[model samples]
Target: MTYRLKYGTGTEAVHDAMPSIESEQLSLALAAACEDPIGATEVYGEDDGVMRTLVTEHAIAVLLVGRITKTVTVLQLSYTG
Candidate 1:
Protein backbone atom coordinates (compact mmCIF):
# COMPACT_ATOMS: atom_id res chain seq x y z
CA MET A 1 0.00 0.00 0.00
CA THR A 2 1.00 3.60 -0.58
CA TYR A 3 1.70 5.82 2.40
CA ARG A 4 -0.07 9.13 2.94
CA LEU A 5 2.40 12.01 2.63
CA LYS A 6 2.42 15.05 4.92
CA TYR A 7 4.54 18.19 4.86
CA GLY A 8 6.14 19.86 7.84
CA THR A 9 7.55 23.39 7.95
CA GLY A 10 11.08 22.07 8.02
CA THR A 11 10.36 19.89 5.05
CA GLU A 12 9.08 22.91 3.19
CA ALA A 13 12.36 24.65 3.88
CA VAL A 14 14.25 21.95 2.05
CA HIS A 15 12.49 22.96 -1.14
CA ASP A 16 14.21 26.32 -1.19
CA ALA A 17 17.40 25.10 0.44
CA MET A 18 19.20 25.28 -2.92
CA PRO A 19 21.22 22.60 -4.63
CA SER A 20 24.69 21.82 -3.37
CA ILE A 21 27.38 19.22 -4.08
CA GLU A 22 26.16 17.18 -1.16
CA SER A 23 22.54 17.56 -2.24
CA GLU A 24 23.47 16.26 -5.68
CA GLN A 25 24.83 13.08 -4.20
CA LEU A 26 21.80 12.85 -1.96
CA SER A 27 19.47 13.36 -4.90
CA LEU A 28 20.91 10.42 -6.77
CA ALA A 29 20.90 8.25 -3.68
CA LEU A 30 17.33 9.16 -2.89
CA ALA A 31 16.13 8.21 -6.35
CA ALA A 32 17.69 4.81 -5.94
CA ALA A 33 16.12 4.50 -2.52
CA CYS A 34 12.70 5.17 -3.92
CA GLU A 35 13.12 2.26 -6.28
CA ASP A 36 14.41 -0.16 -3.61
CA PRO A 37 15.09 1.29 -0.20
CA ILE A 38 16.51 -1.92 1.16
CA GLY A 39 18.66 -2.39 -1.90
CA ALA A 40 19.69 1.28 -2.07
CA THR A 41 21.79 0.75 1.08
CA GLU A 42 22.81 4.40 1.39
CA VAL A 43 22.33 6.02 4.78
CA TYR A 44 21.66 9.72 5.40
CA GLY A 45 21.49 11.51 8.75
CA GLU A 46 20.24 14.74 10.23
CA ASP A 47 20.55 16.30 13.69
CA ASP A 48 17.47 14.40 14.82
CA GLY A 49 18.44 11.07 13.30
CA VAL A 50 18.77 8.98 10.17
CA MET A 51 16.04 8.51 7.55
CA ARG A 52 15.65 7.09 4.08
CA THR A 53 15.95 9.46 1.14
CA LEU A 54 13.89 9.18 -2.03
CA VAL A 55 14.77 11.54 -4.89
CA THR A 56 12.67 12.66 -7.80
CA GLU A 57 13.12 15.21 -10.58
CA HIS A 58 10.49 17.36 -8.91
CA ALA A 59 11.87 17.03 -5.36
CA ILE A 60 14.56 15.67 -3.11
CA ALA A 61 12.51 13.40 -0.86
CA VAL A 62 13.29 12.42 2.68
CA LEU A 63 11.44 9.60 4.37
CA LEU A 64 11.06 10.07 8.08
CA VAL A 65 10.77 6.70 9.76
CA GLY A 66 7.87 6.34 12.18
CA ARG A 67 4.43 4.91 12.65
CA ILE A 68 1.04 6.57 13.02
CA THR A 69 -1.33 3.95 14.31
CA LYS A 70 -1.25 1.03 11.85
CA THR A 71 -0.47 3.13 8.83
CA VAL A 72 2.95 4.19 7.57
CA THR A 73 2.95 7.89 6.85
CA VAL A 74 5.42 10.21 5.11
CA LEU A 75 6.25 12.84 7.66
CA GLN A 76 7.46 15.33 5.07
CA LEU A 77 7.88 16.17 1.36
CA SER A 78 10.55 18.57 0.15
CA TYR A 79 11.71 19.56 -3.33
CA THR A 80 14.97 20.16 -5.20
CA GLY A 81 15.87 20.72 -8.89
Candidate 2:
Protein backbone atom coordinates (compact mmCIF):
# COMPACT_ATOMS: atom_id res chain seq x y z
CA MET A 1 0.00 0.00 0.00
CA THR A 2 1.10 3.53 -0.71
CA TYR A 3 1.71 5.71 2.30
CA ARG A 4 0.09 9.11 2.56
CA LEU A 5 2.46 12.03 3.04
CA LYS A 6 1.82 14.65 5.70
CA TYR A 7 3.84 17.52 7.07
CA GLY A 8 4.35 18.39 10.71
CA THR A 9 2.87 21.60 12.14
CA GLY A 10 5.54 24.01 10.91
CA THR A 11 7.27 21.84 8.36
CA GLU A 12 4.97 22.77 5.53
CA ALA A 13 5.94 26.39 5.96
CA VAL A 14 9.61 25.44 5.89
CA HIS A 15 9.06 23.51 2.71
CA ASP A 16 7.25 26.44 1.15
CA ALA A 17 10.14 28.76 1.92
CA MET A 18 12.72 26.60 0.17
CA PRO A 19 14.09 27.50 -3.26
CA SER A 20 11.75 26.21 -5.96
CA ILE A 21 14.21 23.74 -7.44
CA GLU A 22 15.20 22.41 -4.08
CA SER A 23 11.60 22.19 -3.00
CA GLU A 24 10.74 20.18 -6.10
CA GLN A 25 13.59 17.80 -5.42
CA LEU A 26 12.39 17.32 -1.88
CA SER A 27 8.86 16.75 -3.13
CA LEU A 28 10.01 14.04 -5.48
CA ALA A 29 12.04 12.43 -2.72
CA LEU A 30 9.04 12.48 -0.42
CA ALA A 31 6.89 10.91 -3.10
CA ALA A 32 9.41 8.12 -3.52
CA ALA A 33 9.36 7.62 0.24
CA CYS A 34 5.59 7.42 0.16
CA GLU A 35 5.74 4.72 -2.45
CA ASP A 36 8.47 2.77 -0.66
CA PRO A 37 9.29 4.21 2.70
CA ILE A 38 11.89 1.65 3.66
CA GLY A 39 13.59 1.61 0.30
CA ALA A 40 13.66 5.36 -0.09
CA THR A 41 14.84 6.50 3.32
CA GLU A 42 17.64 5.63 5.66
CA VAL A 43 17.25 5.03 9.38
CA TYR A 44 17.81 8.25 11.26
CA GLY A 45 19.82 6.71 14.09
CA GLU A 46 18.66 3.27 15.03
CA ASP A 47 17.63 0.54 12.62
CA ASP A 48 13.99 1.03 13.54
CA GLY A 49 11.93 1.28 10.41
CA VAL A 50 9.67 4.05 11.59
CA MET A 51 12.20 6.80 12.17
CA ARG A 52 13.73 7.52 8.83
CA THR A 53 15.20 10.34 6.76
CA LEU A 54 15.04 11.30 3.11
CA VAL A 55 17.95 13.22 1.76
CA THR A 56 18.11 15.14 -1.46
CA GLU A 57 20.90 17.12 -3.06
CA HIS A 58 19.87 20.27 -1.24
CA ALA A 59 17.62 19.16 1.61
CA ILE A 60 17.14 16.53 4.26
CA ALA A 61 13.79 15.50 5.61
CA VAL A 62 13.23 13.71 8.88
CA LEU A 63 10.24 11.45 8.62
CA LEU A 64 8.11 9.32 10.86
CA VAL A 65 6.72 6.39 9.00
CA GLY A 66 3.55 5.03 10.54
CA ARG A 67 3.05 1.51 9.33
CA ILE A 68 -0.31 1.08 10.98
CA THR A 69 -1.62 4.33 9.54
CA LYS A 70 0.17 4.04 6.22
CA THR A 71 1.51 7.52 6.52
CA VAL A 72 4.85 9.26 6.20
CA THR A 73 4.92 12.39 8.35
CA VAL A 74 7.62 14.98 7.83
CA LEU A 75 8.86 15.78 11.30
CA GLN A 76 11.64 18.15 10.30
CA LEU A 77 13.12 19.63 7.14
CA SER A 78 16.43 21.32 6.53
CA TYR A 79 17.53 23.05 3.35
CA THR A 80 21.27 23.21 2.87
CA GLY A 81 21.31 24.39 -0.73
Candidate 3:
Protein backbone atom coordinates (compact mmCIF):
# COMPACT_ATOMS: atom_id res chain seq x y z
CA MET A 1 0.00 0.00 0.00
CA THR A 2 1.08 3.55 -0.69
CA TYR A 3 1.89 5.68 2.34
CA ARG A 4 1.10 9.31 3.04
CA LEU A 5 4.03 11.65 3.57
CA LYS A 6 4.17 14.05 6.49
CA TYR A 7 6.90 16.32 7.78
CA GLY A 8 7.77 16.49 11.44
CA THR A 9 7.99 19.76 13.37
CA GLY A 10 11.03 21.41 11.83
CA THR A 11 11.57 19.22 8.84
CA GLU A 12 9.36 21.17 6.49
CA ALA A 13 11.15 24.44 7.26
CA VAL A 14 14.53 22.82 6.69
CA HIS A 15 13.37 21.31 3.41
CA ASP A 16 11.90 24.64 2.32
CA ALA A 17 15.20 26.42 2.94
CA MET A 18 17.22 24.12 0.73
CA PRO A 19 18.18 25.01 -2.85
CA SER A 20 15.50 24.31 -5.41
CA ILE A 21 17.30 21.41 -7.02
CA GLU A 22 18.23 19.89 -3.73
CA SER A 23 14.71 20.31 -2.43
CA GLU A 24 13.32 18.68 -5.53
CA GLN A 25 15.71 15.79 -5.15
CA LEU A 26 14.64 15.33 -1.55
CA SER A 27 11.03 15.56 -2.61
CA LEU A 28 11.54 12.80 -5.10
CA ALA A 29 13.19 10.66 -2.48
CA LEU A 30 10.31 11.22 -0.14
CA ALA A 31 7.88 10.35 -2.90
CA ALA A 32 9.65 7.07 -3.35
CA ALA A 33 9.36 6.48 0.36
CA CYS A 34 5.65 7.13 0.18
CA GLU A 35 5.31 4.47 -2.46
CA ASP A 36 7.53 1.98 -0.67
CA PRO A 37 8.59 3.18 2.75
CA ILE A 38 10.67 0.19 3.67
CA GLY A 39 11.98 -0.68 0.21
CA ALA A 40 12.96 2.89 -0.60
CA THR A 41 14.86 3.61 2.60
CA GLU A 42 17.50 2.02 4.73
CA VAL A 43 17.12 1.19 8.41
CA TYR A 44 18.20 4.09 10.56
CA GLY A 45 19.69 2.23 13.46
CA GLU A 46 18.00 -1.07 14.16
CA ASP A 47 16.39 -3.58 11.81
CA ASP A 48 12.95 -2.60 13.14
CA GLY A 49 11.45 -1.36 9.87
CA VAL A 50 9.70 1.58 11.53
CA MET A 51 12.63 3.97 11.73
CA ARG A 52 14.30 4.62 8.41
CA THR A 53 16.61 6.90 6.53
CA LEU A 54 16.33 8.21 3.02
CA VAL A 55 19.34 9.56 1.18
CA THR A 56 19.28 11.65 -1.93
CA GLU A 57 22.10 13.33 -3.81
CA HIS A 58 21.96 16.36 -1.55
CA ALA A 59 20.13 15.38 1.60
CA ILE A 60 19.59 12.73 4.21
CA ALA A 61 16.22 12.39 5.91
CA VAL A 62 15.18 10.45 8.98
CA LEU A 63 11.75 8.95 8.74
CA LEU A 64 9.27 7.10 10.90
CA VAL A 65 7.01 4.70 9.13
CA GLY A 66 3.58 3.99 10.58
CA ARG A 67 2.32 0.71 9.27
CA ILE A 68 -1.19 0.93 10.57
CA THR A 69 -1.64 4.51 9.42
CA LYS A 70 0.30 3.97 6.24
CA THR A 71 2.19 7.18 6.72
CA VAL A 72 5.83 8.14 6.40
CA THR A 73 6.76 10.98 8.70
CA VAL A 74 9.96 12.87 8.06
CA LEU A 75 11.48 13.40 11.49
CA GLN A 76 14.69 15.10 10.53
CA LEU A 77 16.29 16.47 7.35
CA SER A 78 19.87 17.43 6.67
CA TYR A 79 20.97 19.20 3.51
CA THR A 80 24.43 18.35 2.28
CA GLY A 81 24.43 20.30 -0.93
Indicate which candidate wins on lDDT: 2
Put down candidate 2 lDDT per residue, 12-51, tens digits, no spaces.
Answer: 9999999899999999999999999999999899989999
Candidate 2, overall lDDT?
0.94
Stretches of candidate 2 off by over 4 Å are none
What is the Å distance of residue 35 in model 2 from its true position? 0.2
Q: How far is candidate 3 from the true structure (C-alpha RMSD, Å)?
A: 0.7
Sort the predicted structures by lDDT, highest score first: 2, 3, 1
Q: On residues 4-38, what C-alpha lDDT tens digit does candidate 1 reach at each position?
A: 34445576456437577645665555445444453
* Candidate ordering by TM-score (highest first): 2, 3, 1
lDDT of model 2 at position 25? 91
